[model samples]
Structures are given as structure tokens and as C-alpha cells.
Target chain A: DVKVTQSSRYLVKRTGEKVFLECVQDMDHENMFWYRQDPGLGLRLIYFSYDVKMKEKGDIPEGYSVSREKKERFSLILESASTNQTSMYLCASSSSGAGWGEQYFGPGTRLTVT
Target chain B: ELKVEQNPLFLSMQEGKNYTIYCNYSTTSDRLYWYRQDPGKSLESLFVLLSNGAVKQEGRLMASLDTKARLSTLHITAAVHDLSATYFCAGLMEYGNKLVFGAGTILRVKS
Candidate 1:
């Protein structure tokens, strides 16, 4: 089974603070994604990395950024955390092989910005 | 812009009942995915529909796709309490570069 792990399951931060969420995947997938889930809005992609050191902005990438310095590790950074940025953050990884194989997700990190 | 929409944003069903959730998209896409998310948890992949008329089933859940109509359906048969979750269907746009997700259908199965 593919294993995706996050650094923290829950986190609380003050406004204007910097926050970092780390994700690591056991499988050598080529694609990694960061998403935030909110009630009713479903999951919206924030950033995605297709290769090491490469990144692309998704739909809601304004207040967020991402880093993929290593193949197995990806990190999401909040420049200035705010209450509105508090949401369940998810990390997913998938192989670039045939059929766009299923993206395995981590348990998610629930960040609460106060 | 690519848009994905799911109907009946909320569903309440009884055990031994059957229901279907609808997902519609506004662009040409060959890949569609079904995912289930429990409260306070990340998404779990349910099915991947890669082509028109493709269907997949697991346990009591079934998903099908129709590229021509830009639609997908997730059907639950003989629902159980454990089947309750928020179901979302996402369409791959930009040739699979990104996934556009629907608002999601929150299914609640009562005993």
C-alpha cells in the first residue's frame, strides 16, 4: 500500500505567523499536490509539484506557496497565516504512469489560525 | 474556465435504500475521479473513470462516466451507516494537469 504521512495532524498558529506543513510519501511518485478542504466548497488545489524543485499554482494559491526540494518530500508554506487560512490541509502524491493512477492522500493537517 | 458541479449537495437516506449522486462538468475531460471524505479526514480515492461509458464498483458503491454528456454518477446500493461520507467527483482539465472538483454531496445514512 502507498503511504503518505504528514508532519502534524493538528496545528494552531497566531495571525501573521509563518506556518509550514510537511508531507512525505513512501512511493516514488512524480506528482505531489497541496489542497485545502472547507465545508461545502470541497477540495481546492493550492499548489502542485510535478518534479523536484518544480512547482505550479493551482486555483487558490494566493496566500500559499509550496516546495519540493526532494523527491519524497513536499512542504506547504503560509507566508502570513490568517484565520481564513485555517482549514484541513491535504497532501497527495501520484505516479506519472498510465491512466494518471490514483492519488494517495495523507491523513491531513487541520490548521487553526487564531 | 473549467467548472464541476454536483447535484443534491446533501442527501439523507435510510439503510437498505439506494441513491445516486450526480456530477457534471463544463469542459472536455477524459478523466473523472470519485473520492470520499469523512469528517476531519482527507479524501480517499473511490474510482477513476478514464473514458466514456466506463463504470467501476466497489462494495456498495458504483461510479460511471459519460464523456459526451460531461457527466458522472456515483450510486450507492443498500446503503449502510458506514457508507455515510462526503462524496466528490473531480474532472481532470488541462490534459490532466489539474483537477476541478465539485461542491460535494454529503451523504448521511440513517439506521
Candidate 2:
């Protein structure tokens, strides 16, 4: 079975603090994505990387950035955490070659900024 | 821009009852996906509808896609407590691998 692992399941940070959320997939998928889920807003994409050192901004990329240094690892960085940024973050990975376009998600990281 | 919308954002049903969740998309899409997410847990893939008039079923849940209408429906038959969760429908755009998701339908089933 494919597994997507997140560095933290729960995190609390102060306003103006820098935060990092890590995601690693064992499936060697070429595409990795970061999304923030909010009540009523649903899941909004923040950033995605198709390959190492390649990244693209998604629908809701403001206040967020991403890093993909290795094939199996992708990271989401919050330059400066704010109270409004508190939400559940999800990481997903998919292989383009599969042609299925189904994303396997990691257990989400619930972040609370105070 | 691609937009996905789901109707009946909140649903409460009794056991053995039937319900349906609707997903509508704004533009053309290469595929549609259905996912289930339990409270405070990760999403689990349910079905992938790749073409027009596609219908797939698992257990009591059936998903169908109509590309021309840019619509999809997930029908739940005989609801159960274990099936209570948030259901999300996502549309995969033609341009990239990005998926635009709809506001999920929160289903509460009482036995």
C-alpha cells in the first residue's frame, strides 16, 4: 500500500513565527500537492511540485511556499504564521504515469496559530 | 477558472434510508473523483469517473458522471452509521493535474 507521511499531526505556533510542514510519500510519485482545508471553503490548493526543484502556485498560494528537494519529499513553508492561517493542512501525491489522476493523501496536519 | 459546487452541504439521515450528493462543475474536466474523509482523518479515495456516462459502485455507494452536463452524483443507498463522513467531489482540469474541490457534504447517520 502507498503511504504518505506527514511530519506532524498537530502543531501550535505563535503569530509571526516561521513554520514548516513536511510530507513524504513512499510511492515515488512525481506530483505532490499542499492544500489547506477550511470549513465551508473546502480544500484549497496552496502549492504543488511536479518534480524536484519545480513548483507551481495553486488557487490559494498566498502566504505559502513549497520546496521539493527529493523525489519522495515535499515541504510546505509558512513564511510568517498568523492567526488566520490556522487550518488543517493536507499533503497528497500522485503519479502522472498511472493516468488515473487519483491522489493519495497523508494524514493531515492541524495547525493552530495564535 | 474551474469551480466545483456541492448541494445539501449538511445531511442527516436515518439508518436504511437513501440519499444522494450532487457535484456540479463549471467547465470541462478530464476526470472526476469522489473521496470520503472521516472527522480529523485523512481522505480516502472512493471512486474515479474518467468519462461521460461512467458509473461505478462500491457497497451502497454509487457514483456517476455526465461530462456534457459537467455534473456528477453520488448515491447512497441504505445509510449506516459507518458511512457517516464528509464526502468531497473533485474535478480534474484538462490543463494540469490540479483538482478543484467542492464544499463537502457532511453526512450524519443515526441508527
Give the number of the best model, judged by lDDT. 2
As a whole number from 0 to 100, the lDDT of residue B83 in candidate 2 is: 96
Model 1, residue A102: what's the lDDT? 68
DockQ of candidate 1 against the true complex: 0.66
User: What lDDT score goes with residue A108 in model 1?
Assistant: 97
lDDT (tens digit, per residue) of candidate 2 on A1-114: 889999999999999999999999998899999999988889989999989999999888989888999999999999999999999999999888875478999999999999
Question: What tens-digit string does per-residue lDDT give for candidate 1 at A37-97?
Answer: 8876778899999999999998899999899999999999999999999899999998888
Which regions of candidate 1 deviate over 4 angstroms?
A: none
The CAPRI classification for model 1 reads as medium
- Relative to the true structure, candidate 1 has a C-alpha RMSD (angstroms) of 1.3
lDDT of each: 0.91, 0.94
For candidate 2, list the clashing residue pairs, or say none. Answer: none
